[model samples]
Target: MIKNAIYLLFSFFIIGCVSTKSTLKNVDYKATKPKIEKGKYVITEYANDPKYGYNKEYPINIGFANLHSEEYFVKLFFNGLTNPEGDIFSYEKIETCCPFPSNHNKMGVGLLHKYRVTFNNGTTKDLYINLYEKGEILCPNGFKILAN
Candidate 1:
């Protein structure tokens, strides 16, 4: 039908807009996976740069290459973090944006996930995550790693 043709054309246009070179600044293929304890990642370091997860160009790259489910790793990352006051936080996946090149996917492109994190005091922050690339897992500057 004409509608299906139009939809296909639109899809191609959108895919054509994706940049061939990724803008991500913190992808580390050699980064090792973190230890999981009690269903959470045991993150031991804090990000030195404030933009680590807040900026779309520097997403928290929890690669899916070796993992079976993306949400599993995402949950582990958030469960390993807490507010600065040492209180557990809650998060929700708000959106998916920022497509970039990646060899991990059949399409050779990947999208970034945006999460809204809420603390016990009602404070909130947005974090960008890339499940297609790997990086050193660390707590973002404004947050703290959950105590073991």
Candidate 2:
């Protein structure tokens, strides 16, 4: 019984890491603040202004080569991000949907999203919105927001 129970738990954890349609879709975005091109990423900034806040504090996300795809490529740009001056920007994984919370130990879903990135010259920041099929511009020139 103990071995069976442990196996069940492990299976659930593995399943939970796969993000499905509903999980990655449907994030709310602000109309006033639009997506912009900053460094090698096109991202939507977390509106810091109180009037446009999401009532949540999260890091600005950046996107690599997989910004405009429906399939989760699970890869990053080999040549990391750089600036107009050729300085390489650095990033830290601030958050991860790592060990996802399950619903009744079934129907598990989660995604690895959210990050903190600092651009050269320290000019702009924002996060990569991973909701697919919405025509978000590919990083480097494409950024978009959740439609109203």
Candidate 3:
């Protein structure tokens, strides 16, 4: 119980430090959710900008509002991608960083979830995800959209 309390307090303290303005560059409130098939998101476009998802300022904004779990959306998003050579990929959330203001959360702030994606060929890259806002779902550079 003490550990849980300490964690909660630490979380509050971190959230309290968020800036009043968000720095995310890709949040689109009018963006529509991607279609899901075979437990994966159906992504058709590749991000033209190299910084998309790979930079903290341009996280892949998969909003949590219409979903039950933010992690579920993260999985679906990754599941729809593969290496350029069509090799399957695996990913894990390695860290949460880059707090920013967002009205979507009860704390009025949100943090970016950084994921480490590993391809079958032993290559890895870090991608940042934002759960507090919506944006176009696209395959990042160095990756391809899984065929439907």
Q: What lDDT would each prediction earn against the true structure?
A: 0.89, 0.35, 0.88
RMSD after Cα superposition, model 1? 2.3
Q: Write the per-residue lDDT of candidate 1 for residues 22-73, one digit (tens) a residue.
A: 8999999999989999999999999999899999989998997443587788
Model 1 lDDT, full chain set: 0.89
For residue 147, what is the lDDT in candidate 1? Answer: 92
| Model 1 / residue 10 / CA error / Å | 5.4
* Tens-digit per-residue lDDT, 1-148, candidate 2: 9999998897777676554434332233432222333312223332333321111222122222233441223223202234545565655545544333323223443334444456656655444333211222223422123222
Candidate no. 3 TM-score: 0.90
Cand. 2 Cα-lDDT: 0.35
lDDT accuracy of residue 69 in candidate 2: 48
Q: Pick the candidate with the highest lDDT.
A: 1
Error of 3 at 115 (Å): 0.4
Model 2 lDDT, residue 47, Cα: 39
What number of backbone clashes does candidate 2 have, counting pairs of residues 3 or more apart or in separate chains? 4
Higher-ranked by TM-score: 1 or 2 = 1
Assess the local accuracy of residue 80 in candidate 1 as a C-alpha lDDT between 0 and 100: 95
